[model samples]
Target: MQTPLQFCPRCKKDVAFVAAAGARTCPECGFQYAVSEPPNPGSFPDRPDRAGNPWLQFLTIAGIVVLALLGAGALLLGILFVGCALAFRG
Candidate 1:
């Protein structure tokens, strides 16, 4: 019986899958197809092992720093205003 041809990376061409001894193989190069399913294309690994976008992280951190600086500036200005008011009240 004939089978559909699958591309063989080792053989660099499409070849028929030959079934023998319960395993499918490339006819020309004798490359065996794995029984297990391959991983999906462009899939992410576990969170710890996966890489995230560096630019997004950098922007998030930068935004937080800017907000924090603004908060600190407002706090300092409030303190200065309170001190000046007290000094002139005497």
Candidate 2:
């Protein structure tokens, strides 16, 4: 079921509604018209699903913290081991 075309305000030409566009230009006179939906009492278009998952958010933060701590610990251990080796050699 296709929606009806809207009339161009400038030239009164019929302009079809584009799904992703807000306004369309008239083919006849190049006049722009705002796309409007037909009045339906109980019509709901497909809406984007909410990206709401509590566990996913918690796991992402935990993973970042673990990686940061591991990286810092590894760096500190490397520095300490190298310093101890150099001191013993001297």
Best by the lDDT measure: 1
The lDDT values for all models are 0.72, 0.66
lDDT of 2 by residue, 48-85 (tens): 12234568779989999999999999999999999999
In model 2, which residue pairs have backbone atoms overlapping below 3 Å?
none
TM-score of model number 2:
0.45
Worst lDDT 10-window in candidate 2: 43-52
lDDT of 1 by residue, 61-82 (tens): 9999999999999999999999
Q: Native-vs-model 1 lDDT?
A: 0.72
Give the residue spans of candidate 2 off by over 4 A: 1-50
Clashes of 2: 0
